[model samples]
Target: MRRLRPEPLTPEAFAPFGTVIEADPASAIGINAGFTTRFHALAEVEVEGGAPILSIFRGRPRPLVIDMLERHPSGTQAFVPLGGRPWLAVCAQAPGAPLRAFLARGDQGAQYARGAWHFPLLTLAAQDFLVVDRAAPERNVELADLAEPAQVALDG
Candidate 1:
């Protein structure tokens, strides 16, 4: 098995795949009588053939071995942690492309670009995530088997 170490997630490192959703002071706006700071437009929701829908995904801890990856060809997918638990986002530019893993903090979220290959959610602990994606009758997921399994190394 191939071993892959996840790097800490940042906007610059993750820009190739998609946007990193988090509260940015540069994009902050004081609203609601200056009591609430709204981090507006952190990520864009792109849909090709369907409307976007909101859903909650409860993820459980799993082994860090990656055997396959999936992608949404018709829309972007966003995962925002509701439980404030760190998680992993594994992605590649295309099928058979070199893979990259990111270790995202609890306060951070990820929005995978349309047609971007990514492994399913890898939660460090049991947690809930607010998901935004397309809702359509047609199947939107495409799966590809990796040439070899990659084991994610969490320890430095």
Candidate 2:
């Protein structure tokens, strides 16, 4: 197995995938103070293997972080960290706008940006992640003629 650590997470880097964990106003914010929130079930493409494969970090102590992969004239994306060490695996497709990744130590994955590309939540040990995304009759996808790639790393 190989050790994969991408450069600082960025929307341009995560263009191939959709936004990862996003904001949830309903989910429990803490032990007792939380508002209504939403949940992700992994970004789907309505077909068998039509989406990107959930790549596993294959390492231990995965570090998860609360980062934002934003897209500007490129697209939107999310950086979901898996495992204890906090490794991130984004699940997104076709970026259309510019995005930014705001990752931190105490942050959790949240909602998908409007027109922002995103991915499913990936666990370091597991090659599977539950994601939240949007796919309607009208799909939002884009290609970067001259795009750059970003990597996600958590300080967990």
Best by lDDT: 1
Q: Write the per-residue lDDT of candidate 2 for residues 1-156, one digit (tens) a residue.
A: 112233333434543443334344443244324553335343332322133223322333334432333322222333344332333444333532333333322134333444544323434454323333333344445434314344444333
In model 1, where is the ten-residue run with the lowest total lDDT?
90-99
lDDT string, candidate 1, 38-115, tens digits: 999999999988999999999999999999999999999999999999999999998778889999999999999999
lDDT of each: 0.95, 0.36
Weakest 10 consecutive residues, lDDT, candidate 2?
45-54
Question: Clashes in candidate 2: how many?
Answer: 59
Per-residue error at 9 for model 1, in Å?
0.7
Per-model TM-score versus the true fold? 0.98, 0.31
True-structure lDDT of candidate 1: 0.95
For each of the candidates, the C-alpha root-mean-square deviation to the true structure, in angstroms, is 0.7, 10.2
For model 1 the TM-score comes to 0.98
**Backbone clashes in model 1, listed as residue pairs:** none
